[model samples]
Target: MKKLLAFLTLGLLLFLAACSSEGGSAKEPGNNGDTSDSAENAEKQEVTFWHSMGGAGQEALNKIVEEYNTSQDGIQVNAEYQGTYDESLTKFNAVAGSDSAPSVIQTFEIGTMSMINSGQITPIQEFVDADSYDMSGLEENITNYYSLDGKFYSMPFNSSTPVMYYNKDAFKAAGLDPETPPATYEEVEEASKKIVESNPEMKGFALQAYGWLWEQLLANQGALLLNNDNGRTDTPTEIGWTEEEGKSILEWVKRMVDDETFANYGTNGDNMMAGFLAGDVSMFLQSSASSRDVIDNAPFEVGIAYLPHPEDKERQGVVIGGASLWMIDGKSEEEQKAAWEFMKYLQTPEIQAEWHVGTGYFAINPGAYEEQVVKDAHAEKPQLQVTVDQLQDTKASYATQGALMDMLPEGRKIMETALEKIYNGGDVDEAYNTAVEQFNVAIEQANAARGE
Candidate 1:
């Protein structure tokens, strides 16, 4: 009886030991275990970014996105190209408030008022305020365009301004100082005559009937496009510039037309660029974004100069042109946070320098100018520094801050039509008056549509 009892005790001990071993094995790395906590931590937050970058811009942006993705383990960003700004905005409107909406969307500067009115975006101000992010480090001119009522709605990314690109060889041939390109409407007119006289084969100047250029010209003269302080303080009811200020642009173009020195590209920037490259045109006004392309493609030396103003008026500056990143509403908190992180990453000096060199767009972060890559690029292509100088030289004013209105795209079309009329030798007064009338009607219609 004693031996049987001892055997039962040993058997019981063995069973308990077996149970303890099994439990320990379950907690080991290779065994089935409760890993819910680690798995949840391992899962990445996904952010969808819709952008309107194509070609070289798209390539540069993709590289940046890839770098951002691999640099971290907690979040992943997927950048989707959504065609041009107009097309992208349309797609966004279609999907807004739905699950398919992107975490972030890029809209052109002109789309600022429209985006603000859409109520579909979360103004970046929320993040900026919550994080106490210092925006003073960014380029003031760029921040100026994105800020409204002293608050940033979107984060400025790619920005550019209009500049006059002249052929140094052509200027020399015309007996004009190649280093000193024209800086005023009158001087441009005079240079155009000389350039035409130098070579009958090449036209002196080419102005594409682009509405953006028209806006730049007006701003250079410190003229506003809309009333009520460029629609910053209050809604604009009519054209802001006086009759003389408005007519000055028309008359200037008319003088070139009469002189037969104007190469009218008629709203086609590609053809204008082609004409300049092929030596069919000597000088033209275009975005600083084209600096690298023009300088690399031109057979002759290219000289970039600031946008010309009227001789009588001081140059205020060109408004920031390009797009800003808007954080879409209704996104998950994690997604929004990820998107904001990516934006801040983009504004870093190294990244901004890469972006500035890759694309001819200005670095929104002024610190990027100190990056070695940017310094090397500037040294190799001195023409690039001219763009930075021009932006720094710009005076702070409502005109330079640009006009904000939902009807700006429509107004651009109206102005383009007016410029075309003048380009085709139509009556300047007739075209100007018709454009002013149409512009006011468009503004009234926009205000009514908004129930303002």
Candidate 2:
């Protein structure tokens, strides 16, 4: 009876030992038995990036995103095309503060004020502060636009300025120097007349009724689009440009209209671009970002020049026209960090070179100019260098830093209407007065809405 009892005890001990061993084996070090933990470590943090890049810009951006995905194992970035800037912003408004919102969004320069007010974005300044990231290497003009009061609210990405695109062949035919394109409004006017004289079939110039172009034209003449130092110091309440400064542009257009040298593609940039491509227009003002498309598609030799200023006023330069990447709020810290990493990757010299050459957008990182790809591209298309030079030569000023206001998009529409009226031979004084009154009302309404 004693032996049997001992045997039972031994069996019980053996069974307990076996159970312990099995349980220990399941969680042994380096063993993937705990799938939850393994997955947590192995899964990559996903970043959703919403952008408005289309055509060549979209292609280049997608390539960069793919490279970024493969380059790292910890994070994967998914870039979503969200259509035009205005359209994307509208969609963002719908999804903001919800899970449907993107991790990062690309907003245009003018949307800076709106984005800041939306309360849906975590300013990139937070990331910069946390990471001790140095932003000094970026182009000052670009950084200047995104920065307010010495703090960067967003990451400057695809930046561009307005430039005058002209046909070198047409300039030569007009008995003008192809190497020296128009430098002033008067010069442009003169060039336009010559171009018309040379080819009755071709219009001298076509200024698309684009509000952004109007703003740039004002900036080029050292005129602000809003008061209080372009709303950088304080909220604006009225028109910033003088009556004369604003009227000069109107008068210039009126002269072209009267002379039949202006091609009125009312608010249709696409049609204006088509006109240039079809050799129906000799010279036009457009974003430098279009440089690649214009140079590539045009059969005639293309020449890019600085945005023309009034002959009386010194050239103050152009405001950055493209968009910046904003980090959306409500995302996980890990996700925001991951998105920030992607943003940093984009600002690298190699990537900037690719973006600049691919889309003709200014490389926010000046170091990109040193890349061999940029060197080769500049060698092939010297006109690309003109865009760079123009940006670099821009004299820093409040006007050039651009205006900040939520109503800018609305204001642009107002200006567009005024420009169309002028293009159609409407009375300049009437158009200007109506535009000013409407613009002031917009500013006042925006301020009232903000309770400022």
Candidate 3:
């Protein structure tokens, strides 16, 4: 049955992850918990950064590093692209044993808990205290996902939240107010009916068939994604997606799909982008980090708004969706200090503003919005302002602070499989129950491996 398939799929993923981490060439001294010679890092003028960003994200990152390098006379910061987030993290584990390990690497949002468990990274608080760095300007809501016990494990760089993007031209033709977008799932459903009535050839709403978006849907409705305060206060032994909150989301999706107001675009993000660009869908939801790409590619005027939620519950806000920079443990003092300096320089309002404008990522530093460049951009496209406003309005809660799970990657895949099954005519309750069961298996595997 489809339910059993989902369980087997995640079980396979767990097996592969274990084998890779513990067997064969993947086993090295400094990676995945073998920090043997990490202390032998020599004093060198060069510091390296391994990142997974590609395309526009990579270009923006390269530009910032170039400016940082030329701005100073001593340390030379070099960046290397290591493919997607998963591939990059695997590569980090592979090289963590050698001096070749990057001084600092960019690990994606979900990897935060796993990176902390790896024992290969040094806490940023160590360097921050040594240098007396001021971190007051960074947004607390954005930093919460990367922090633990009032301290940051890594330096948050590219951060983003989910937002609803609609075609303004389609709204006008559909007789809906372009200025006032849907604020709740009930409103979205109503608006979808009107839009589909006006334009029968186009779908009313389409979101990526990705687990992260579904997780955001629950979080926005004040639902926790994991146990123990999103795994902040304690390590979660089981997943938290089998509750009424998840069922509510599944029911909404089922309604939309049944009404032909929503349809599957597959799991790839490009499917969402392609469908929207070709006019197959009227509105969509994706990461704020994709703002630049969407704004550039859409042929119509794209309007952005905060993600809609259930009408009955208040919004708890969304979680940060991008990566952060982590200092590798065992480097020489000089390299460690230089890496810290580069991280601080990158956090400046001026640099943060530039990165935000160039890549459509959050400035991380709230002060960056005050910069002239950001102000001008906001004046040009008011949609840019929505992301910032949404962050400011987020309620500080366990749900909004975000979840930390060592099996997060596997959990996401489980959610993705459930969505695929539901869209393909499977029972929503059965699909979700399967996801919960599979995720618990992964949690147990992670706990046992970590000696919990």
Model 3 regions lying over 4 Å from their true place: 1-44
CA lDDT, candidate 3, residue 183: 92
| Lowest summed lDDT window (length 10), candidate 1 | 31-40
Q: What lDDT would candidate 3 get against the real structure?
A: 0.85
**10 residues in a row with least lDDT, candidate 3:** 35-44
Q: Please give, for residues 168-286, the per-residue lDDT of candidate 1 as tens digits.
A: 99999999999898999999999999999989999999888888998999999999999999999999998898898889988999999999999999999999999999999998999
Every candidate's lDDT: 0.93, 0.93, 0.85
Which residue runs does candidate 1 get wrong by more than 4 Å? 1-42
Q: Return the clash pairs for model 1, or none.
A: none
Cα displacement (angstroms), candidate 2, residue 386, comes to 0.3
